[model samples]
Target: MSIGETPARPRKKKKHTGRNIILSVVALIVIAGLVAGGYLWNLGRTFDSNSSKITDAFPAEETRPEVKEESKDAINILLLGTDTREVRSDETEEDEFATLPGGGRSDTMMLVHIPSDRKNVFVTSIMRDTWLDIPGVGTAKINRAFASGGVPKAVETLEGLFGIRINHVASIDFEGFKGMTDAVGGVTINNPIAFRPVHNKSYYFPEGEQKLNGEEALAFVRERKAFTGAGGSDYRRVKNQQLFVKAILGQILSKETLTSPAKIQGIVQEMAPYVAVDESLDATKVAGIASSMLNIRSSDMEFFTLPNNGPGRSADGQSIVIPDMDTIEKFGEALQRDTVDQFVASTDLSK
Candidate 1:
């Protein structure tokens, strides 16, 4: 069977809405993994049994990078947030069927790299529109990897780009993002600069510390049209995503959240139905992975974007982000050698 043929479930075509853009559904999985411990037995079992499982979501082993003995204990997880909703009535056919795969483009792609020592967790966000080569397809936007061949193509494209062996993969539905925020009783983030978005003009976000409910939080991370100028939209959007993730982490680690078993349980159970992970990451494996990172705290996580040249037009006139390949090449080498700290320090990761 073709790699993309392994179905998680039948796709139900939902109408396109402003909330279609998912920001941190996969990040919730990472949070779940970090929180897993003696308490994780139930979380793991609940998550494993309730969530969908993607069969054969990875490419052939021969084509993947081998983990160096020195970095044997390190893990790289590809976290993707996808939207399968149909295009709006006003959209063109090209917009609706722009890619081969029916699962739709991955709205968010983050590589969560956990070093062997587990002292720090690094998250590198890959711009969805970064022009890159997709396996079995010519060069195109990196997001197209998911749209063209589902999880396997997305995995293959990333491995080929970073030369890193992905230990696991996870995709989450956008609805999970809202459920998780509500389950945690909401998250607060300090807004650096804010404005009302075009989609929802009535929702005014002032510049200051802001407390956001589930629906408002979704709008906060997904607003790009409010940022004017070329390249400004995605640049600010990515930063918002990182900031929101950090806030969620803080809330999760807070006394209120940690002390309340009901809250944590609510988060896992509420989010489980919207998540899908590789077949290998079953209950036992998820719990094991989580237990190993039990020492991880919100302060230890570092989030940054993969360096990219400023936004520009493609040869065909489509707007795209030019990746900094030279730096990316070195980044790949660091992943293999487990010297990402050194690489991150020396590299100019400015977008």
Candidate 2:
């Protein structure tokens, strides 16, 4: 207490305020960011592992066109579906490669066009048996491109035929197809005619609206031959496919699915194994597209099938779907010019 002695500095009082809370928040945010980063990194690795990159997929002229990213210019995705099962044997890896031709035949193929407005998506299914010119390979069945050259060949064939750029490609197994249907809680399709598919006589779908679970849905889509109505044609099958797709969109955009990000992620994880995507279809690309298109509802999507003549036998004795080149050319032009709206308005044959 000596007068000359400096009063002991009062220890700075520990303040309980926003700053303390802010510091704690900042620490939490940093930790959370690190964890999220790690999770995303791991997810990316998983996606990359399940996919095969196509270096020669696109021809030289394809990379030329310039369009604003995520604009109304339209983004095109080539979706190839195959009934390929993952059968592994004790055979060496080299033998495994030998067993797969092109990349295994894509039983179903479609071009998914997402216009810039983000209001709706356009899906056009291509008949798998269409005979067409495969770039650097001889003319053959469209599905044969995968068997001859893998996904790259398939992509190249389609891109060459269509005269447009395919931004990404996703090849999916039948299990993935079935799994996705189930993940979306199954799809409800309106059957134009009641028919039991020859592929599976065990089940029958009555005409009109039908709510189908995964197995039933797959059967519904695959029943082209058993359809006695309209000759049970391939085009008929395409219609079934389109109908099922619309139902899927409805299910995915339903409040039940969109409200739960964890559920969506879990579904995607389950689908990953049965899917093989292009190198460009990484997590960042997918996330960016999904975030931008969040406003799109199932009602906004439209589906169609590429124009094709009825089945015919080729000179080589292969059954094939002949191309309706005139209509297809118009479609290609509309697609190239990003005027798919016009194409859909006038040339959507499936309607």
Candidate 3:
């Protein structure tokens, strides 16, 4: 250790330190870019996917009646869940449960109203078996609208049924629903009964609060027989579906999911393929709606089934849900005024 040796200069240490700092900065930049890019990409994708394709689906400017004061607020959308069993022919059997070879009836029909004020989201679930006008096809089951003429006809039928203007349509298949549930690491459902379906022989889930996987979650919502164990029926099934939607929305908004890159990507990818939007639904509209929806919470969402009692034997001896005209009219008025309180006040939830 001679003094002229310059204390054996720590060149190696300096070089290592420099390399480590550079690597650390690069990693941070990459991660930040990914997070930012994912957020922007997802926002853009949702906007594009949800825009309406059919501008004429609504009346033209000339056709719309002119008023002293025009309403610039609020938008209404139709959310459809189709029961198609086949999406891809080559996919494994397990993944093919939700995909159907051809288009089938819609298992779920929901009309979502997002007011211009962005205060809350109103959801009304229509029964699949509800008898309604099928446009050119005469009277038929409401679910048949989608199968007969696709989304446009479905929208038309719904518009006619409810007497409200629908601005957009978002239709997703069964597989997409399952994929979303799995991507979010499953959802928690409060089971009100302890019953099992014949198909799910080994899938015995006890009644109570339980976490559900993709398959189990699907079965939970689709199980009419199980919900009936405690005197359940289609009405009970509808209630469960509403609860499931709320649970899903809550899960999606949690910080655990919003901040996870891998989970977000998985969800977006799964949702992209099976979702179809009207041609008019573009990225801008979707982004605007999503930005507005950020403030909405599970508490802000309201779900209710159309008022109806059990099915009755018609003149042909076929069972059909007899719609109570008075109840339906009350529901329609509440919707037209965008007042859930008005609707729920007059209606009975215990039916």
What are the runs in model 1 whose C-alpha is more than 4 Å off? 1-39, 84-86, 89-104
lDDT (tens digit, per residue) of candidate 3 on 223-337: 6655543224566777777888888888887889878867866777767667766666666666567777777777887787777765665566644566666787776655566
Model 1 backbone overlap count: 0
Model 2: per-residue Cα lDDT over 1-351, one tens digit each: 687876455343234445678899999999977876676666667666655554555446543344434343678898866555453463233223312223543556889988767677888898877879977778777766765666667777877777777888776665665766777777778787788867568998888987787788777765567655432466787788778777877877889976665656556766777776666787788767876897888777778777877678889887677889889888877777777787888764852
After superposition, which runs of candidate 3 have C-alpha atoms over 4 Å from their true positions? 1-38, 42-72, 86-104, 225-233
Q: What lDDT is reached at residue 108 by model 2?
A: 69
| Runs of candidate 2 exceeding 4 Å displacement | 1-73, 85-104, 228-233
Best by lDDT: 1
lDDT (tens digit, per residue) of candidate 1 on 66-103:
76887889999988765555555753443443232235
Cα error, candidate 3, residue 97 (Å)? 18
TM-score of 3: 0.74
- Local lDDT at 165 for model 2: 71
Per-residue lDDT for 142 in model 3?
66
Per-model CA lDDT versus the true structure: 0.79, 0.70, 0.67
Better of 1 and 3 by lDDT: 1
Worst 10 residues of 3 by lDDT: 63-72
